[model samples]
Target: MQLPWMSRTDRRHWKSARTTAALGELMAQWLEGSISSRPGYTPRYGPEDETRPLVPTLAALCRAGYVTTCSQPGLVGWGADDAWWEQRAAVEGVVTDPVLLHRLVDAATTAGLLVRTIDYSRNAPGEAPIPVTTRNCETAGEFGGRISEADMAAQWRGLNPDLHDEVSHGTYVIILAPEYGPTGNRLWRILAGSVQEVGHAA
Candidate 1:
């Protein structure tokens, strides 16, 4: 589908597409337990500064409605591809983050633009949980270091005193950026529900 906000004639579009496609390929490699750096892409700073290839591509996808922003830093969601096409018909814009793509997906879903399923699973014993919606499942468990259930509860309490009225059993809380929109909020809710269901099934 043709996105209105995206410049079809811009050279940046081609560059961003290449970057996004390269990131996709690299993500595939990571998922397969392989770690090979992209050729000719050397870090100007720390080893952790490898987000260059991901950023612009994410912007393109977000502009194109392929993903959405999430509460977590460097995290995003996959939106309905069909809805993306429909939205593309409305206006022209630029998506600077993949998280916006997810937001578009959420908007599309709420607008009855598409139907989607949330699939979630726990990793094997001694392993981390797997978020099926992400392209890089290996990074799912790295969000936060291990914390005792009691500590988790204490942290949650510290952050949300109002939640004290709610039961804390089996609850896991993580902080996210405050700028999230309605679509991102809904996606988080869905993800939480999926986690609860998976835990119950196990």
Candidate 2:
């Protein structure tokens, strides 16, 4: 069902729009007390969406302002579990390389972020305790401009695969506007209750 809100010229790979629409359906379901809006809540995407799973929690982030409709008391950014990482990975694009990706992972360990390319090793994570900024994103872009997406998804998944089940996705999202694109895309992996919670939970 093409609701009145969806764009008429949406492309197959246009992730931001696709994600938003799918999430909106979930939000409607959430509002009607459908109550199954879990992190990997991929049960439906209406008639116009591709047959892919979507993490419904992102619906809260799709808006222009901070979300206030969550039944839970805390922000999804600081409260989601490792399972959220896997759910997100299933919906978004992924990394092209793992080893170089981890090297970049070690680079931005301070504010918890990951980049979408092996090439992302050349930049820096900016000032923020939460997932924020693109001051040092891949030279290309997260939307297939140059860099990839899975690299940024790996941060919260972390290094210990035994613990994070989806350790392949890691802990953070990637960086700023680089020379390789029409626009730089940013991915934020606001999962695992932040790095400190991860450390103390151990």
Model number with the top TM-score: 2
Superposed Cα deviation of residue 128, candidate 1 (Å): 4.3
Count the clashes in each prediction: 12, 17
Expressed as tens digits, the lDDT of each residue in 1-202 for candidate 1 is 2222323442122223333333333333322324222212221221232233334433343223222222122334443542211000011111223343345445445543222322112222222422222332332222212344464343223212232222122112222212222333333344334324433554
Residue 125's C-alpha lDDT in candidate 2?
Answer: 42
Candidate 2 regions exceeding 4 Å error are 1-54, 64-111, 116-202
Model 1: runs farther than 4 Å from truth?
1-70, 73-128, 131-147, 159-162, 165-167, 170-202
Report the C-alpha displacement of residue 102, candidate 1, in angstroms: 20
Residue-by-residue lDDT tens digits, candidate 2, 104-193? 345444433333332333444433322221223312112213223453332221112232222222222333222222121112233222
TM-score of each: 0.19, 0.20
